[model samples]
Target: MTHFKSQVFLILNELPSGECIGYGELAKQAGFPGYARQVGHLMKNLPKDSKLPWHRVVNSQRKISFAENTDAYWQQRHKLESEGWIIVGNKLTLNEFDQKEER
Candidate 1:
């Protein structure tokens, strides 16, 4: 695997349950600050059964990247909700769900 992919994978693997990072944040944490779009693309292509918590990664706006009410959107919503996420109106509704806040 490329160094970028390796770093990203390591970060993802270590990501705690119910926690999330934005795509740009993930790229920056992986040491590739401007590669947010690339990180999203790479995540899009991950295997359907992959164990990576891709759903835990949100957009910079801290919302589900998928369109509202689509299958992908609902799927991601379900996964996140199961993790105690409180999303409403396409937004990660509660302060607790905000990744920027101190937990």
Candidate 2:
């Protein structure tokens, strides 16, 4: 995989349970400022069996990037809930559980 995508997944895997990093934030953390779209691309292309905590990544508004009521969004919410995250009003408050460890 490309270095940036690898870095993105590494950062994701480091997040503590119940925490999250938004797409924009992750892109910036991966050293590509203002590259939220790139982060989305990376997530879309990640292998299905990869161990990355892909569900912990969301949009800047703290909402699941996928459309509400869709299978993808429900799955995302389910995965986050499985990890102990709370979803309220389309927002997942994860600041308290953030783990900014480097890859």
Candidate 3:
């Protein structure tokens, strides 16, 4: 794994269940500001069966990155919802449900 990928994974694991971090925020925290797409690329390479908290990351708009009907997106949604997150319309607002202590 790349340094940035490991950093992003750490950030995701730190999130409390039911909460999420935006791709932009993750990239910044991983020392790659303005590189959310790079963050996404990192996520895309995560081992499918890995125990890392992949569901804890999302787009800055607080929306899941993939379509709902697709297995990947549905699995993400299911995992988040199981942890008490609610998907409202096309957005998954972490502002109201984040588990991390605000920095």
TM-score of every prediction relative to native: 0.88, 0.80, 0.82
Off by over 4 Å in 1: 95-103
Winner on TM-score between 1 and 3 is 1
* Model 2 lDDT tens row, 1-103: 7888778888888987777788899999988889899999888877888787788888878888887878878988999878866788667754324434331
> Which pairs in model 2 have colliding backbones?
none
Q: How big is the positional error of residue 61 in model 3, measured in Å on the Cα after superposition?
A: 0.7
Query: Distance from true position, residue 74, model 3, in Å?
Result: 0.9
Best by lDDT: 1
lDDT of 1 by residue, 1-103 (tens): 8999989989998999888889999999999999999899989989999999888889988899999969989999999888878888777765455655756
RMSD of 2: 5.3
**lDDT per prediction?**
0.88, 0.81, 0.80
Model 3, runs deviating above 4 Å: 94-103
Q: Which candidate is the best by TM-score?
A: 1
lDDT of 3 by residue, 1-103 (tens): 6787778888877877766888899899878899899888878888878888888888988899998778989888888878877788657754434445454
